[model samples]
Target: MKLYDFPLSGHAHRAHLFLSLIDVDFELVAVDLASGEHKKPPFLALNPFGQVPVLEDDGFIVPDSIAIMVYVAKKYGKTDWLPEDPQQAAQIQRWLSVAAGQIAYGPCAARLVTVFGADFNANEVIARAHSILTLIDAELANRDWLVTNRATIADIALYSYIVQAPEGNVDISFYHDVAKWLRQIEALPGFVPFPTSKAGLRAIS
Candidate 1:
């Protein structure tokens, strides 16, 4: 298995984190977003969307971060991380949508501005980050995990960007439940950290 990754990308990091958490042996292929490598023909063939975190396992190809996690969980028979129960599965999928939608526009976009110098309006995205985070904080108040009693892909899906939200100028300190949840994920066996950036350090400091 190989994962096309960008070190600074939360999208890629989420996929990377899941692969590690599942104790899989996979090679990491770094994509040079700085040089437009993902946009080039070679990488575009893997994912026309020109994104990192594309997974290639033997002859099969999987694109998108959450998709990669699903593929990996199903492939490895990790039912704990992705339950098969109808209601539980639906709940997990819902949070995945939140990850792709709310998390994307919120925390992810905010961090993009600081970490990669993306052109998003920082204030707007940061505010958006807080909105979703506030909801997530409320949801987490009565539960240890999002969709079920145990850790699932939903938690993995939401972990990356929210953990680093402070870097986006979206302070997470006030969200006590969210902060505790981050620590829980971090403490998981085989957990791999999303690499912190100097920009993130400066922002939080």
Candidate 2:
């Protein structure tokens, strides 16, 4: 398996974390997004959307971070992570949607604005995204992971961007539950640190 990714992408990090948790061995191919490589012909052939975290598994190219997580869980991980019950699977899917939808638009977008200063309305984006975080904080008030009673793909999918919310200037100090959850994720066996650069915007294209 080969993972074509930008090291600093939170979306890519989700797949990275899941692969690590499952102890899957794969080659990492760095795509220099800084040079518009993703948009170039070679990379575009792998993913037309020009996104990172494209997983090449035995000639199958899987794009989208959330989809990669689902694939890994189904193909390699224990049933506990992916679950077998339809209701449980639905709930997990709901949280994954939260990660890809609300969390991506809110906290992730805020971080991009704060760190990269991308040309978006930061205030409005943050305002809308904060509500999602508040919902997560409340939902996680008494839980260890997002779905079921233990760690799942749901947790791995959401962990990277949500934990790094501070880097985007979103105050995470008030989200005590989230902070605790972050620590728990860090303590998990086979866990790896989120990749960082000396300058936060060093990887921006």
Candidate 3:
């Protein structure tokens, strides 16, 4: 298996983290986003959207991080990470949608503004980040994981961006349960951290 990754991308990190946690042996192919490599023809063939963390297992391709996680879980028969129950699957899917929607426009967009200089209203995105985080904090107040008793793709989907949210100037200190949840993920076996940017360091300081 091969994963096309960019080190600084939380989206990419999500795929990488899940694969590592499952002990899947996959080769990492670095995509040089700095040099417009992701926008080029070769990479574009893998994902027309020009995104990183596209998985290539044999000749089959899986694009998007959440899609990659689902593919890996299903393909590898690691149902523990992704259960087969209908209601459980639906709940996990709900958080996955949050990860793509709120989490994207919230924490992800905020980080883009700081780390990549993307043109986005910092205040708006940071506010959105806090709003969703507030909900997540409450949801996690009585549980160790998001969906089931154990960690699932739901937790993995939300992990990357929330942990690095401070980089986007969204203060996470007040969310006590959220902070503890981040540590729980970090303590997982074969866990890999998302690389912190200089902007993230400054924001936390």
Which candidate, 1 or 2, would have the higher TM-score against the true structure?
A: 1
Q: Which prediction has the highest TM-score against the true structure?
A: 3
**Which parts of model 1 are misplaced by more than 4 Å?**
none
lDDT of each: 0.92, 0.83, 0.95
lDDT of 1 by residue, 1-205 (tens): 9999998899999999999999999999999999999999999999999998899999799999999999999999999999999999999999999999999999999888888788999889988999999999999999888988878999999999999887787888899999888999999999999887767545448
lDDT (Cα, 0-100) at 167 in candidate 3: 88
Clashes of 3: 0
Instruction: Tell me the tens digit of each residue's lDDT in model 2 across 1-205.
Output: 9988787799988888888888899898999988999999999999999999899999999999999888878887478889989998999999998888888887788777766667767777677667887888898998888888889998888898877776665666788898888899899898978875433233441
Report lDDT (Cα) of residue 87, candidate 3: 96
In model 2, the worst 10-residue window by lDDT is 196-205
TM-score of each model, paired residue for residue: 0.96, 0.93, 0.98
Residue 64 lDDT in model 3? Answer: 97
In model 2, residue pairs whose N, Cα or C atoms come closer than 3 Å (at least 3 residues apart or on different chains), thus clashing, are none
- Off-target runs (Cα >4 Å) in candidate 2 are 197-205
